[model samples]
Every structure is written in C-alpha cells, then in structure tokens.
Target: MTQLSLRNQLVTVFGGSGFIGRYVVQKLAQQGARVRVAIRRPEEGLFLKPMGAVGQIDIVQANIRMPMSVQAAVKGADIVINCVGILHEGGAQKFAAVQARGAEVIALCAKEAGVKKMVHLSAIGADAASGSRYAQSKAAGEAGVRRHMPQATIIRPSVVFGPEDDFFNRFAALAAFAPALPLVDGGHTKLQPVYAGDVGAAVVQAALDDAAAGQTYELGGPKVYSMKEIMQLTLDTIHKKRLLVPVPGFALKPLAFALELQPLFAPPITRDQIELLKADNVVTEGAKGLKDLGVSQPTPVEGVIETYLYRYRRGGGKFEPRFS
Candidate 1:
C-alpha cells in the first residue's frame, strides 16, 4: 500500500493550541504539512506559528459548537483532526456540547467539505453506559464521528503524560506544599500512561496510513501503574517523602464540589473527575496500540518526567544530592 504523503498537504487541527493538540500540530509541521490551527482564539494559538516555517502554520478562529465556523475551518483541508476535549464542564463548555456534539459537528463538516481523511482523539474509558458524564460524553462523541465519517480513525489514549500534562505535574506540585497526597479510592485504579508525543505521532500515522481508516487504536505506555504507584513515582522523582493518604470517594465528594465552585481556570479536582477515577484507565489486553500505529517504543513516565518535575523539588532540586 502506498502511504499518503503529508508534504505540502493542508491539515486542519481543531483545538491545536491545547496540551495534546500542540504536539499534533508540531508533528504535522515537521512532516512538511501546512498546518491550520483551528482554535477558539487566534491570539492564543499564535504561539504555534514557530512550529513551522513562516506561513506554514496558520491560526484561525474556530469554535466547534458553531457549525459555520467549523465549516470554515475544514474548508480546503485535505485532512482534519479533532483534539477538542475538556476534562470538566465549565460555563459554555459542557461535556455534551464540547466533546459529544462538538465532535459530531467537526466530522460532519469535514465530510461535507470533501476531506480525504479524518482523525478523532478520544479517551480510554469512553462508554455510553459509564457513570461518569465525561466518559458518556466521550462515547457519544465517538459515535457521532462514526455516524458522520465512517472511515475516520479513532484513537483512544490512556492517561497521557508529558511536560504540560496535568497528571504527574499536578501531584508533584502538590507535594511541594503539602506534607501528604490524597490517594482517591486508595489509588488502586490502574493506568497505562502513554507519552503525549507518542500519541501525537500515532495521530499523524493514523492520518498518513490508509489501513488506519475505520480503525480504533488504544495507546498505552510500556508499563501500567496503579494510582498509588504513580504518586510514589512523583515523590521519588522530586526527592520528596510525602505520605500517600487513601481517601474514599464518598469522603472526597464534598471537597471536589467545593473546588468545582471556585473560579480557577482548572480546579484541582472535580466531582466528575472523582467518578472517572473509579474505573481503571489502562489499555485492554491484546488491544491495538502505539506499536501498531508505528510508535514502536512508547515513552515511559520515568524517562522524561524529571525534565519538568525537578522544579517542584526542594530548593529546585539544584542543590540536592542525587539519590540512588
């Protein structure tokens, strides 16, 4: 099979300014593809221009909730990737509107615009019957995408970690100030933490490989670790000895709710997030993953976490002696 060439191809990525989306845009730019970053605010995405040569990357204002704007974003693009997703609901950004309906709108717009291929980013725990509204919304979004573009490649990734990721970075920052870290539900929930860059590479592969059409890939790292182990790893990396306290779901709901009410851009933890932690976020056994999508060796958390996490260590970890 002849692989598609991304050189000079116009690829539009919705939410291209986000944590995961930036990596996708960078990968596409590296492939010599002309990247159109569709974001809510053009100014917010202007930083992406340096990822490519002058004029190779263009930032356009787009909101998936607005069909006309989505149409404008998909117009004249050979491929489209939807990376727009939210962890929690906020004003005008509900799970249903952004993840579910927003995905459908993009898929439908791409189909109408005569796009050659499409890729959709989804989460591992997306399920219609799941208790978490976040999961249910993600499942709905996948369904909507399939309904509109049957040949679209859907990539479901487990907990993704990187320099800008919230998982490890959040806990590591917490340990700097707090003496202990709360292990929700004893932190028993297992997760296969795939690197953000690998997932981005997988998305690019799915776009270029014809066989990936109509396929679903679950991306995970080389190893799976429980939530407790993940927290311990953070402490170990930052040279901190913080207590891992086990807190049940019922006990944390009140606090989660209060946090949600705060005006912070991203609350420390939300009620829906607590519900999401109930289920394991690992890739299924024997499921297709990063290897199948051309990412031969997905990155492990320990391999790259210290690059950004060292700042949280005491005295910035500069004066501390290296501990074996």
Candidate 2:
C-alpha cells in the first residue's frame, strides 16, 4: 500500500454508496482517511462500513436538495467530493435541482465549513451549450462549484464501466436475450470507456495534489472505441453471438422520447439521453488525463469483461471444453 498518510483527515463524499463512490471510499480508507458517506438515506450506505477499518467510516443522512442537511454533512470535513447525478428526472429530483442548484448548495456548505479541498464529478460532454439536459446540468454543476470554491478540481470522465456498471452489462444482457441490439445512429458516436476504479483513483489523486487545484481534467481510457466496437466487445466477452442492428436516429428518437415520459418507472430510453448518445463521449482535446492522474494506461474493457461476464453465460459460468 502507498504510505501517503491521510489518517484522521475527514472527507465527506456525497453519494458514496454508488458504484463509483464505493471504489473512491475504498481507496481513501486504505490511505487511512476518515470518510463520511453522505446519502439521502444513510441506511443505504451501511454496506460501506466494511470497506474501511473499524470506526474509520461514517454514514450520514444528507439530501443535497436541503440546505440544512447539506450543511450538517459538510461539518468537520477537510475535503468534500460530490458524486451526485441523475440520468433521468424524478419527483423533487429534477436535473436543475440536483445537478445544478444542489451542487451550488453543497459547495456553499463546504466553504462555510472551511473545507480545504473540493472535487466535483462531471461527464466528458459537460457543456453549457449542449443540447442534452444531462450534459448541460453537469456543466452547470461545475460552474456552481467554481462559484463557491475557485480552487476546486473538476473531473470529467467518459462512460465509466466495471462489474456493476450500468453501461456494458445492461447492453450485454440484452444481447443475450434479444435477437439484435439497437445501435443509436448506426453506432457512429465514439467513447473512451474508462474503468470506474480508475476514475476513483483519479479523484483521490486530485484531492491530495496541490497542483491539481483550480484545474479540470478529462479522464479517458488509453484507447478510444466506437459505440459499435463497444457492443461487439460486449458480445465477445459474454460468448454470445448476436447481430447489432443500427437504428436511424430520426426513426427511433421520437419513440425514445415518449418512453422517457414515465419517470415513475425506469424508462428504457429518454429523449435527452438519446440526444447525448449522438455526440462522441471521448475525452477533450488537450486535457491531461491518466498520465497526470498518477495512473498508468487505464484498464481496458477486454481484460475486465472476461472476469465478470462469465456469470451471464449459457451455463452461468465460462464455456467448458467439450469432449470429442
């Protein structure tokens, strides 16, 4: 283990129970930091206790929507990390409220608490002028953080994947069941699928490094792949033989928009999300990414999928050799 001591330093991680948050908490805990995971419902984060030494982690109920709760969570924190985001809108959890205003609220509270460092998790496509609501909200969140803490570090990652990721696994599973999987706009859009663990480590590195202050980093994997290539990789990993059917955006976008209306139930597709897929989700032009983050080339999907996707095979395991 690296001997950089963060012992007794308090870090309040918003949405630390999430897939990416778990990895960040693990890294910080190993470094001997006292981590406080702030979630809307603290009970949901109890599983995080096992990731750290006894009494090293704390779970607190804090909804970003509420100023008082956010303020309470920021109390005694040396550093604050915001991982809160939503792909779809919900009651009281709209994009503007959670991603934009909620970020401002958290930054304000962290500043009031005299926190020394702050990190905001954003997407690679975060642009104030973006057509997608998700992209726009991410940019707004970054602006919100900068407004309160000018020295805060903002990290923008391409699609993050891991064992429990919602990206590859979801599509791979559909490939197993369905005859063909639809590729948005002929799968032309490109993406650099960085591992979730890599993103987590990058967050930790930024928090500990003074030079990273007031800077924005775009994190991506070593190589870039088209959306079609990602789907093909998923198929190969799962040992599933399937054809990728490209759907014209003009034909499918309307249906997706209608499907997103029922936010009450998890929507298969949303108009905003469909629009997002139209743009390449790779890293920015001249941003320092894995090289500066102290991480070697990020883990590729090819090596990771074989480890996790085996469970989804025909026999619920890897393919066994057949006797002649």
Candidate 3:
C-alpha cells in the first residue's frame, strides 16, 4: 500500500521515549504527524521534540498501569500505538500488570476514544503456553488488544537491533570488559534481528494503511543468526576476540535466582529471559511479515551495528582495525 499523508493526524504513542519507541516517534514525525508521546515522564521525552516542528510533537505524562491516565492520552487521538513492555519485573511494573494489563487498558481506552487506527507492538515468541513469563504476558497483551479493538493492527517483531538497542550493544559491552563471553545453551537459539528503523517503518505503515486493520504482521530481518554467532559478530564488530564459553541454561538458574533475591545494578540474565532463549526467536514460516506490508527486504544488522559497536574497540573511535 502507498503511504498516506499523516500531516494533521494525532498519534498517541505510549512508551514513545524507549529505544524502539524513539525510532517510531521519529518515523511518525517524518510523516508530519502530530505525535502525542504518552510516557510516564513527559520531561524524559523532551528529546523527541526536535524530531518534529515547534508544536508538532508533544509528550504528556501517562502510565498505562493507570487506566484514567491512558484514557486521557487516547481521548482525542486519531491513532494510538502501544509499545510499552518490560523485560524485568520492577517495583510496580510486573509483566502481567504492565505488558498484559497495561495493554488491555490502552486498547480499551483507544476503543472508547473511537481511535481510527491502533497499532500494538508485540514480540515473535509471544505464546500463552510458553514457560517464559515475558512471552506469556506478551501473548496476553495481544489477546487484550484483539478483545478490545478487533481491528487493531498487531506487529510481532523479532529481536529488534539498532544504535540504541540492548541486544547487540549489551553483548559488545561484555566483549569489551569480559575475557570470555558465555554462550547460553551453546548459543543455538536462532534469532532474526530486525532493524529498529525497519520496525518503525512497518509500524508507521500499519498506522497509515487501512489494509493493515485486523492484521498481524511478523517482522524479521534479512538473515538469521544463532545466539553464539550473534555474540561472535558483536565481538568482531568491536575489534575484540573473546573466548566464547559454552554455558547451559540450567547452570544459570541458581545465579539468576540469587541475584533476584538481592538487588544489583542489573541481573546479567533473568530466569524469564533464559526461558525465552530456549525457543528460536524468528518469524515462523507462512506468517505474514515485512514483505507482506511492502517492505520487500528489511535492513540487515551489518548495515547499522558496526557504526556504534566500533566505539567499544580497544582504542578510541579513530583506532585502526585490529583484524579488518
């Protein structure tokens, strides 16, 4: 479908200050949409203002956990986008509360407001039967959206990567400091990392096209890489050669439990995350994906990862390649 003008359309993007949300907000801004970035802290998303004209973008304080706040955010918007999700359960942000119930609140509010288009962002491994709480909550969120607004567009993107992403950069940071990087479950779990921008484009496209209504699009990248391969690729990008140590998922369980017992900076890997890697995170065969929405070939990881990972090289940014 050809892109339609979003010049005067009001789009309320929940979690618009996040990594993927920032890209989505920028894409919507590019389409000349008046974006209402509804996040918990309006001040945090101040950076998004420059993406659009003087008054084209606005950030209002709203948390989906609170239905009244979400209702107000979607009240006058023409379209609503929910990208709010949490990897770990923090104080008041449990997986069921935030990912599942929060999604329900947003969808209900959008429906009540009579929003024309609603785009809900989910993950590829969102299955209710999955052992992982993250995946189960995501699946519940999808069900919530469908129940509230039958026509809402659902996008299940496989591991998104970009400059500001956690997947590549986290592994790269590990390579820079750690002598050896652990390959959980022998790093056999397959992942198709879709570029954050490509996801943003697909998301904005869904919002603009009427054909996307009542559809679910599975977005993936150009190629698939194993978990170990991804770690190796990150090390290669950062000009490092760290030993890839094979670590079984079961061995990490006790450590994850101990860390959860006592607070630290951030747990290296949560138990739920470990459960998630047990299954391949890729687009399923016959599932509607990027190409189905006019994105013939999504951007590859190499195109964007090296640009930022280079910062983690042994030397500074201008350092010559060690083994290019």
Candidate 4:
C-alpha cells in the first residue's frame, strides 16, 4: 500500500475513538482515505482532526446498537470497519445488544447501503459454545457479519498491547500499589500479544485491497507467553518484584464478584474476565495470521514495553533499572 493512495475512498469507522479504533483511523488517514470517525462522542475524537489534511477527516455520531444510527453512518461509505467489541458487560451495554446484535446491524446496514467492503475486529477466543459469554457473543457477531456480508474481512487478534492498552498497563498500574498480583489457575493460560499498530495496519490493508475480501486473519506476535510470564515481564519492566500468588481459578470467583460490584470505571476485575483466562488466548495452529496478510514479523512485547512502561518505575522514566 505504498503511495497509500485511498484519497477517493470514504471510510466509516465505528468505535473509532477507542484504543484500536484510533490507530485504525490514523492508518487510514495515512493511506489518504477520507475518514469519517463514527463514535458515541464525536467531540471527544476532535484530536484526530490533525491526523490528516484539513477537511480530510470528519467525526460523526453513531451507535452500533441502534440500527438507524448504524444506517446513517454507513450511508455513503466506501469502506466500513467495526472495531466495537467490549470486554465487560454492564448497565445498558450488554454483550448481546452491543456485540452480537449490534454486529448484525452494522453488516445489514452496510449491505443495504452497498458499501464496497468491511472489516470486523474480533478476538481469538470467539466461540458460540464457549463458557465465557463474552466469547460466545463475539462468535455470534462474526456469524452475523458473515451472514450479511460474506466477503467482509474478519480479524481475530490475540491480546493486543501498546501504550494505552488495558492488559500490561492495567497490571503495571496495579503493581504501583498492590503488594501482590494473582495468578489465576497457576497462570498457565497463554497469550500471544500483538501490537495495536500492527492490527491497525491490517485493518487498513483490508480496507484498500480487494484481495483481502472474504478472509479471516488470526493475528499474533512472534512469541507466546503464559499468564505468569506476562505478569513477571510486567513486574520486571516496572522495576517491581511483587509476589505472584498462585491462586486457583475457583478461588478468584469471590474476589471477582466483589470487584465487579465496584464502580464500573474503577473495576479491578470481573467474573467474566476470570472465565476468559481459564483458557489460553493464543493463535490457533493452521490459521491465517499476520504473516499471511504480509504484515510480517510483528513487534515483540520486549521491544516496546520499556518505551511506555517506564512511567510505572519507582522514580519514573529516567530511573536506573532495578534488579531484584
């Protein structure tokens, strides 16, 4: 996509203000696409205006949960990308409404509006029969997308990590005060964490390339690390040596329940999250991944963690590395 010419295309990005969504918008802008960032809060995404030339990017209000909103957003789109999956369910944003049903709305509206192509952001664990409702809903969403737009590109990325990511950053913040971090079910569950930027590039590729149509790409990083390994890496990066308690999966239910009862914005953990960690979150064998899409050799966790995690160090970014 060098020369990255997409100036003639109009890309409507749902949830474009989110972590992965923002990166997608930036990459599309790089490709010279006229981007319409569809978000719940259009004003909040005002900062993205500078990502492209004047009048090249616009913000629109849209909620995937509402069919009319989704219809309005994709009315004249050349490409539509749905990066709107949720990890937790609370209040009015249930898994069924937002993930499963909402996905169907997007696909239906896109089809009716005659969009050229679409890309849906799903996770590696999406399964309809899975114990985790979050994963099950995601599977439903994929089914809906396939039903409406068979050629739509679906991307199932393993754990995604970057500066503003929720995984390592959340644990790093926890380590700032907590004496110890829990290793649910002995931390054997594995995760191959891919970089957010890489995923963004993949979405952009799906948008511009007709060959990417009717594809499902499972994206992961170069190495896969177990939950404990990830926790250890987090501790090391932040110059902390907190104890990693080997708590059985069953024991965390009570704690997760209590944590879930906390204010939604400040939740420490949720029961559904515990269920998700029960299984490994890695790319499945024989599946098409980043390499298949020509996004070769994705960035490793070690290569980028130190760049943003230094803020969690005892004395901050310039502080000397501490060894335990």
Question: Could you give candidate 3's per-residue lDDT for residues 1-324 as a string of tens digits?
Answer: 644679899999999999889888998999989999999989899988988999999999999888899999998999999989887887898999999999999999998988878999999999999999999999999999999999999999999988777788788876777899888889999999998888888888899888899999999999999998898888888888889988999998898887776765566678899899999999999999998776887898998888778888867475332110
**Each prediction's whole-model lDDT (CA):** 0.91, 0.86, 0.89, 0.88
For candidate 2, the 10 contiguous residues with the lowest summed lDDT are 315-324
Comparing candidate 1 with candidate 4, which one achieves the higher TM-score?
A: 1
Alpha-carbon shift of residue 254 in model 2 (angstroms): 3.0
Model 4's TM-score against the true structure: 0.95
User: How big is the positional error of residue 250 in model 3, measured in Å on the Cα after superposition?
Assistant: 0.9
Kindly list the per-residue Cα lDDT of model 4 for residues 195-237, writing each as its tens digit: 9988998888877667778889899999999999999999999
Identify the candidate with maximal TM-score: 1
Q: Candidate 2: which stretches are off by over 4 Å?
A: 1-4, 262-265, 317-324
Give me the overall lDDT of model 3: 0.89
Task: Supply every candidate's count of residue pairs whose N, Cα or C atoms clash at under 3 angstroms.
Answer: 0, 0, 0, 0
Give one digit per residue, the lDDT tens place, for model 1 in 1-324. Answer: 347999999999999999899999999999999999999999999888988999999999999989999999999999999999988888999999999999999999999999979999999999999989999999999999999999999999999888878888889888888888899999999999998999999999999999999999999999999999999999999999989999998899998898888885587788898999999998998988898889998887898888878888777844231210
lDDT for model 1 comes to 0.91
Better of 2 and 3 by lDDT: 3
Worst 10 residues of 4 by lDDT: 315-324
As a whole number from 0 to 100, the lDDT of residue 122 in candidate 1 is 96
Ranked by lDDT, top first: 1, 3, 4, 2
Query: What lDDT tens digits, residue by residue, belong to model 2 across residues 1-324?
Result: 222347788999998988788888988898889999999988999988988999999999999989999999999998999988887886788999999999999999999999979989988999889988988999999999999999998999999988777788787777778898888889999999998888999999888887888889999987899999998888887788888989987788777767767555566667787889878999878888877878887888786767777777788864442110
Better by lDDT, candidate 3 or 1: 1
